[model samples]
Target: MDIAARSPIGTRLNGLAAALGDGLRTHGHWVRAAQWVVVLVYSVLIVVPAVLPLPDETAHVFTHLTVFSQFVFWGIWWPFVLLSMVLVGRVWCGVLCPEGALSEWVSGKGRNHAIPRWVRWGGWPFVAFVGTTVYGQMVSVYQYPKAVLLVLGGSTVAAMAIGYWYGREKRVWCKYLCPVNGVFNLMSKLAPLHYKVDADAWRASYGPQSALQNTPPCPANGAPNTARTVRIQPVNCAPLVAMRKMEGASDCHMCGRCSGHRDAIALTVRSPNTEVVALGGHLATGWQTLLILVGLLGIAIGAFQWTVNPHFGEAKQWLAEWLIDREVMWPFAENAPWWLLTNYPAQRDVFSWLDGGLLVTYILGMGLVMGVGLALPLAGATRLLGPWHTQRFYHLSQALIPLAGCGIFLGLSALTVNLLKHEGVPVYWVGDMRLLLLVGANLWTLALAQGVCQRYATSRSRRWLAQAALLPALALVNYQWALMFWIW
Candidate 1:
């Protein structure tokens, strides 16, 4: 009574913290019910319409967007989801992904074995991402429901199967092999808030078995029953992320399973660049750098850009002329089938062998061009910054996330802009919009690069020199983007 009376404010603060932590972790039946409702709605809206035939022109409210499914999936859903990852750190993955939920539900019914060794490889995420990306493009997954079923639906089935076989009541499929897993991991590092633990307090409250009753079970899924000398790992971490060593948001699914374990952890706010500027050196890899700089920035640019790119047209025309002189028919033959290209004859459109070849050339050429453009400068930065190594280079290269992310966003947004324009909505300011986005991305990248040099370089001169080395590559990326968005 004496202690309580003496420190009423402190006691109230402790009580408040406990309530906040509990609230953060709680996922009531209504929440689960809402998620199930979303899952059902997604299945109807996304998968069902993909199987239904493409709608007539009058059915299309937003011009050539053509179908409600396509419009909602691409026009509204994907663009905003990507933006949400930057702003909210994968709340979509943690809370609403139908595939993720299905996989977990199935795993609850299956063998519940430990994840295998091969599944734990770091490279699988990137490989899965590239495969998904390439396959989506090959099948024109966005425009066709059958393709969507084959691509997105098929992946969902695979995820459930993986969950059933590989882990106990967990999301092994997502943590290990989901195609967008790596992209999400990289993007999540830019999130503005995350649950952070105070290890000391956690250890104190749960240091022994006798303390168990005093420390309530987390009450979340797989919540700890009674605190004891805490194990080396968190018991309920579904994504299998090690809690103690979690300094960044990259591996966190933010499931809140660990919340209020010892009254030690809480949601905290920080800058989006917190991880990129601090722990990136250790987390970055050459593959990720290449994926961002070339795969996303280059090949993807061409994938999105080719339709509007006159250079692609000239190249295709030149090839057509050459083939005509020789009288070749293979280019005109739709021999490869619909799965390999856009071959919807009912729509009065199909991609011939020539179109497919040209697309491959465009994507590869852009990758080569933009990759070399960025790589040579990074090589130069490595030489100037010293202690040259691929890992070091890769780590330093991550400073481009801001620029790369912006490029990807703008590319996706072009689909939105195109649809709106076709619907007869005025979009005269799109060029200016692209310009603003590009400029913002460039500045953000430059600022991050300067931060990288400051944190990693040995001296002030080296920092400036490293930044100097980065400018040429950044300038080239911006120049090319300008060419795509404005000059061309």
Candidate 2:
């Protein structure tokens, strides 16, 4: 071991990591305790204000945006959750996710049906993500407490429903159907902490003993227990993470159920790109490419930027005028119920059909434009980098995951900052902070691009030229973000 790993603090941290992994694996009581606590706290927080009446705006006890539910949900929770993914991967999904917990708790009592092939579809996560994003906007989910209960609460219920019907084990809803699953999976790649498993050590230690009398031990004999810890069998991994092929932080939710099974898993610190760079074979897929392009780099940017962008008003007005000239006026009617759209006439808050249509077009058009901008450069990158084809193009697109990940974070953070500002909290430095983050994320993208090309491009010239091809995509994303924050 290196000097750093051997140091007292490092050793202590390692010990703690081992202990945490074991506890998560073996401490069934503790896990249930946490789930119930989350259930209680989140149930009250999400359900109460949504069902109850909103506080009277004129009755002034607190300042602007005194609605505690909205403040907590939007201002604090959303932004910090995104931040946590970057730092600790999907610890939220594994540990304190009330939705996941609820689903699992309900699923335990439900039938263990055979998982169908449709449930294993690769495009579900991407489709779900875009659907949720568009729907959330349509219903003003982030702005209203009731919308929160309606949308997020509906999702929580759906998770339970799906889990109740599908797979005998594993969080089927989380693994396949959750809108945020793909987002969390992508963001988790940037986390520095992961439980690394040595397959060789694992097999050597307990390959023969994998099937204990009562399924004792772990997945491949990894996650060795410490002296105070009793040897326990590894339980089924909830997210269905494969130990044999566990290469990145993408799939593991850090649940720790499989921590000390084969006595091979150990928590270790690494650079953020450890997984981004280590992802072998196919770097990404066409679906994944769409996710980064249309979803993250494109729609995410447009989603956060449209209201702030002056062009939105011009476009909306032009469309309105065109529709009026054509004598099609019904689209302007804001008659949709609040449950269907954002029609709270009492609060002077209603979204016309025109508004909903314009929003979809604006976001889709922005995404299409950005995706094209990226695709063209990436096409060049593929040609420069390899005996290129559709799959290779998809593979090479992984180079920009850093950029995509950052765009999503910034977009969400924008909403968070807005909520704080509404409550009269000072977020004066948000613009500058965004600029710094943009620059840092861009630099990280460039570095990752360089590394990817060097490792994959076969020759020195190809490596350099491939990186050159990726430059424009990086530049295109940076330009759009700059236009959003700095210029028109």
Candidate 3:
């Protein structure tokens, strides 16, 4: 018998080990389940829609042309922008993002890549800093119509290309460049949910008695079952391993990857202590709930425009009447030539404000609200949901912020669609790119909201799987709304 040859006994043992890795392993189950969902949805919704065109070619043509032209020429107001900002300070990223879920599931097979201690500590502050600055300028650009189209349209193509080419390291577009991501991150403070670890449990799980404890090794590579490990810095090891270390590093995506190995679990707290235990899980605030509400509303409105009203004839007529009958009338007599009144200052002001500032003002104002308001709310819609403990006020506020924001935007969008439709203005994608940005931003909020809600109910492992499922679902919804005109 050759030693290298796998005989019956050897083959059996190998098969058993593989089975253990696939079946017994928590990560394996989560990843496989998520993958299955992705495959199912991709086939049912995405591929099917593309192959079988919608009956309304005129509408469908407008939709495709809209998406394409927006990507090329216009493209604006997407939900992910708000969601990215919201996730930055909230639980949305860990709870909602499909990519994060996929990464967590796949990470099970690979060793946890511990970012160098320095990088985890203070080295990567520039990532957030640069992201903030870029977002600020982008928000300003959205105020100008032409600038909105050019910048947003160009960025979308660039983001996809970058994601395909160089997304592995730096997560360049998702982590740093994409305006949508930036919005979630910025608005994260507004989210009501967070992933928090039990300090005591975290410490005990990753402590010296690795084999004896129920918890597995630290997923982020803390070297639990080691003896000859060298600690360069006091905070080099996980907080449990190194008592001096307090909270886990900020770069932690809070995917529950550490806990998914059955080593840790997510704990919800109304008022988390500021002590900051290193081995503990991530914390999400209530801000995300509000963000989600806002997002859903935005989606409803955006979809309505895509589906119900493809043109803005009514909007143009109303604007013209408002300008000609209301403002332009004062300048010229009833019998006077129309041209005399058409060139009036009031007319120019209306044109400049609407043509130039309308989209930009809305985008910038909304961005500011998402970024700042997410953090500002400590109290929220109480009567609407029902009064509760004062301690829960902060948490409640987080949930409402996104919801209210979504409603406001959605309402505005409906009005805009109706008004524009009445005015003879064709609702082309280039012109509606700003709305696209709004849609993307809101959808992201909804996903994050789902994650936050899930965190409150589900286990770490299950939540990870949920996150994986959300992304493809979003893509499906987007494709349907765009191609089939099923906005609802």
Candidate 4:
């Protein structure tokens, strides 16, 4: 019934999409094989590096296993994975994630108990993301293998344990507790491709007689009578998504498991802004808004900026002087173990109590400041459009996803540049590339804001007013990036 399905080109596209989906359904073993391959590579990258000696200053990624693992995990793997969410949704989560695979595998043979209410809490994604992000920063997870082991390895173990105790063959941890689930969900809203579900087709397929229309009678029924109807076997979605009701890419893992189910779902192309512009307002939540403004824009920036920010050093010095004047030295003298803090005496990397406290304070401080800063313009935009609507505010906030996602990508790719620099690889264009990405992201964000405003504002004048109120927010975001990439 779709317009695209009526034309020859559209028909070909649909055929390709159907083939892609049905192939996954019929040849599931291929997907399992791919999952195992990723799991094997992931195991080596996560486990092997943690036990190996730290790469020396002179070592290169190609020449050293430790450095290679670090490059692969932080530089190439994570940055590209984040980008992939925008390009093709959470294919990485469903197809290639070792933790998801392991969790689902363990879940298949475990107790298969009902999910606890607390485990299904809506705020878990936000809390888990913030917790893991802060903890990773505190322990310098990006730089140290022991810290990586404790953070990422520990997360894997917890995922498996949660699987063992929770739902049968489901990604319980990924659904509610994965540290990056909230982030991926937000980013995937911009993905150009997703599993599109046809509600009418699904309903038709579920009709009393439709399920038995094409199939032979079951042996249990003992006859092939046309009068009998049977229920269709349901798709066993690992993420436990309600396939027929799915409307957005935010939660769908893009595993293709439920694709073509009831002749409804199919992998389809769409505009990048389709999800946010069309459905964001209706589906937006306070937690997602907080995750965007506070978690990503605020805490993430602070975490990445602290190392390079001259202000952090200046503040640390001022505090150190004050503590010394009062003979308060313990905070400066004591450091936690590597698992708890970034302590590696041989590598001359250690975080004293003062360092740890200040780091947490700074990150949280950034979150509060940035959250309030971004929220003001959004609040203004919401009010400008009409009465103060919380949903409207959340909808407008979705426009910032492009900028927020871009900032995180830039921050992560900085690690890639740093690693390449260590290997004597010239990356002189990195700054130019960052600038282009920032500009493009800002433009994309503004365009999305315009699209959202059009939906809410009844008149051109009102829409313009709403957009005017959003400029300050965009400016604030840009200013933060300027500090990190240019001013600092």
Best by lDDT: 4
Compose the digit string of candidate 3's lDDT tens values, residues 1-488.
11114366545543443343334234635644665575354233223333332223233224553322222221212333343433333233433443333433333344344433442332123333333333323333312223333344345445444444432322334443433442344244443223334456655544555334443456688655454232221111111122223232233333333432323333222111121111111432233232332232233223233224433345445665787866664422333222211112322322333322333343334344443433333222222223433433333333333433444334335435433454456876533654565475445445443434343323555444434433443333344335323333
Which segments of candidate 1 are over 4 A away from where they belong?
1-24, 62-66, 208-235, 324-328
- Candidate 3, after superposition: displacement of residue 29 in Å? 7.1
Q: On residues 1-488, what C-alpha lDDT tens digit does candidate 1 reach at each position?
A: 11223476645644564454456468535445766987897788766676566877566554332366676777778778777777767667767778888888888899988788898887777667656666677667777777877777788889999989977778898898888777777777777756666778766765574366465678786576765544443456667777766777778876666766555666555567777877787888776887777777787677777777788889888889999999997887876777778788898768888988787777778888998988999888877777777776887788888787788788788778866775678999988888887788788787778877776678889988988998988888887677778777
* lDDT for predicted candidate 2 compared with the true structure: 0.76
Q: Model 4 misses residue 251 by how many Å?
A: 0.7
The TM-scores, one per candidate, come to 0.87, 0.88, 0.35, 0.95
Sum up the clashes in candidate 3: 87
Q: Supply candidate 2's per-residue lDDT for 410.
A: 75
Off by over 4 Å in 4: 1-11, 208-213, 216-228
Give the worst 10-residue stretch by lDDT in candidate 4: 222-231
The global C-alpha lDDT for each of the candidates, from Candidate 1 onward, is 0.75, 0.76, 0.36, 0.89
**lDDT (tens digit, per residue) of candidate 2 on 230-294:** 34555677777777568777788888777766667866666677666656245466778888888
lDDT of 4: 0.89
Q: Looking at candidate 1, what is the lDDT of residue 359?
A: 77
